[model samples]
Target: LKFVCFNNDGIDEHMVWLIGLKNIFARQLPNMPKEYIVRLVMDRTHKSVMIVRHNHVVGGITYRPYLSQKFGEIAFCAITADEQVKGYGTRLMNHLKQHARDVDGLTHFLTYADNNAVGYFIKQGFTKEIYLDKDRWQGYIKDYDGGILMECKMDPKLPYTD
Candidate 1:
């Protein structure tokens, strides 16, 4: 797996992931800009972006740094449609969490997930903090679906060893 910054040449890869994200929001949102995908990809810091693949990108995730927070936000995470639910997401998340713990001074990682993803996040030990009952995400979220904000703590609680 290689961590790559967004290059204009990566449009195709970004589009593939963006479509998946938009599809998740389609039920409540409308008219997603294809350019937004490119913008988000390009705007991310090089070190914070990662693509996992042996040869070509099979999956990818982005970490956007946020203020008043130590851990960056897990912005976009996608595994190819054909590769979903096959443990790629879990592997990607584990890598992301470790990167935050070992490299970045991250104590917590956060994201807004949809109905289908809540269970996945929970299985990863992420707990729900609050549910935005309505479309609090406005242009970003779909009106028909509620948005769940979840967080995973990164501070490892280990037994004290004298």
Candidate 2:
């Protein structure tokens, strides 16, 4: 079991993992549009950190880095229904946090979580109190009705993956 970060660079290994992640998201997130998930997963500007266990993609987090703005906006995050409550979600998120901070030098992470996912995000250290500047993320993030926007500030001192 490992975490793979794909930036749509067309690498053969990452592409395979991306396909698995797309399928998982489509299956796990019944309320999200499949077409939307596919588009973002394949988009070059966006990136995904996939959890591949036993060579199968059990989960992933899709995000866009705004390094200059110091935050990476999380577009989609999900784990397979069968994999839920098994700690894969936390590890996937921790890996993403490590990538956002170590690889991209991002200082914060943000996401719009639906009601069902608020609890999960909260457990992952995200808060509804967005300390981010409005101008930095105002037009950058898309609004979804009934979704609550949350933010998580990265602590440079912590090894998030640990």
Top candidate on lDDT is 2
Tens-digit lDDT track of model 2 for 1-162? 888887888788888889889998898878889999999999998999998888888899999998788899898899988889988899989999999899999999989898899999999999999998899889887888778999999899799876
Residues 1-162, candidate 1, lDDT per residue (tens digit)?
654433234567755544444343332223334465445555634233345466455666655644334555665566667767787677667767766665665667667666677898898778886333223333432233355677777647422111
Computed on alpha carbons, the lDDT of every model, listed in order, comes to 0.55, 0.90
Instruction: Please provide TM-scores, in order, for all candidate models, with all chains considered together.
Output: 0.64, 0.96
TM-score of 1: 0.64
Off by over 4 Å in 2: none
Q: Which candidate is the best by TM-score?
A: 2
